[model samples]
Target: MANIQYVTKEGLDKLRAELDHLESVERPKISQQIAEARDKGDLSENAEYDAAKEAQGLLEMRISKIKDQVANSRVIDASQLDSSKVSILSSVKIKNTANGMEMKYTLVPETEADLSKGKISVNTPIAKGLLGKVVGDIAEVSLPNGMEMKFEILDIKID
Candidate 1:
């Protein structure tokens, strides 16, 4: 079964746009390349033709995957999100217990996660631990490196 991904409307639109670009622009370009390569010589040992075919295959795979994601995606309404607890689309401000370091992140789907933008994937360890947590709640998270860390939730807001 394909996993149902929860995404924002903007995220879903981005995926759809990408899929359209791959199918309309990229697919035709690759087809042209394959046709040009085939006109060059025999197909038995044509590296250009082989490369073009491989690229087309990869592009098709990407399109298929994106289509699947689009089909299974459910867009979350930002206005409907609860600000009292950490959840998808919630911007959370947390302080590390050990060093008192503070960080803010918006919990999003994996496809929309951008570390530089302070958007963290919900599947991430810190986000998972923070889920359903309210202000002043302490969340214990186990990192992939086998280290445990504690974060105190300072605030939650729909962003």
Candidate 2:
């Protein structure tokens, strides 16, 4: 079974647009390539045909994976989200307990996660630790470097 993924309405629309592009544009391009390759020579000795077939297989797999992602996706309403605690689509401000460094991150779906924009995926370790934590609560998160860090929730916003 595919894992459920939470996304905003805009994120869902982006996914749908990408899927539509892949189906309407990319799929035909691959089909055309296959057809052109097939017209070149016999199936037994044609390297181009083999390559096109492999490309088509990869394209199909990508399409299927995206389809599954879309199917399991759930849209999160930003306006209805509670700002009392950290959750998906919440923009949280936290301060590191050890270093006293402050940082803000928006917990979003994987598809919408952009490190440059300070958006972190809800499935990430830090975000998971922060989830359900309200202002003034501390969250202890394990990092990839085998170090544990503590962060104090300062603020939470849905928008």
Candidate 3:
């Protein structure tokens, strides 16, 4: 069974647009390449034909996977989200307990995670530790370097 992914309406629209591009633009382009390669003659020894076929297979597989993801996806209503606790789509402000450094991050789905934009994937250790934590609560997270860090939740909001 495929996992049901929770996404925002914008994220779902992006996925749908990407799938549409792959099916309409990419699929037709690959078909044209295969047809051109076939026109070049020999079937068994044509490298162009082989390459095009391989590309077509990869494109189809990607399309299928995206289709499945779209089918299993559920859009999260940000307005309905509660700000009482840290959860997906929550913009949380936290302070490093040890260093006294403060940082703000929004917990988002994997597909929507962009660290440069302060969006962190909910699957990340920090987000996992922060999950279900209310404002003023402390979260202890273990890093990949085997070091433990604590963060104090300063505020929680839906962004």
Q: Judged by lDDT, which candidate is best?
A: 3
Candidate 3 residues lying further than 4 Å off, grouped into runs, are: none
| Ordered list by lDDT, greatest first | 3, 1, 2
lDDT-best of 1 and 3 = 3
TM-scores of the candidates in the order shown: 0.95, 0.91, 0.96
Candidate 3 global TM-score? 0.96
lDDT, residue 20, model 1:
94
* Span of ten consecutive residues with least summed lDDT in model 1: 75-84
Cα lDDT for residue 143, candidate 1: 99
84-123 in candidate 2: lDDT tens per residue?
9999989999999999999999999888999999999998
Report the lDDT tens digits of candidate 1 across residue range 41-124.
999899999999999999999999999999999999989878899999999999999999999999999989999999999999
Better of 1 and 2 by lDDT: 1
Q: How far out, in Å, is residue 99 in model 1?
A: 1.3
| lDDT, candidates in the order shown | 0.96, 0.93, 0.96
Model 2 lDDT vs. the true structure?
A: 0.93
lDDT of 3 by residue, 35-134 (tens): 9999999989999999999999999999999999999999999888878999999999999999999999999999999999999999999999999999
> Per-residue error at 17 for model 2, in Å?
1.0
Q: How many backbone clashes does candidate 2 have?
A: 0
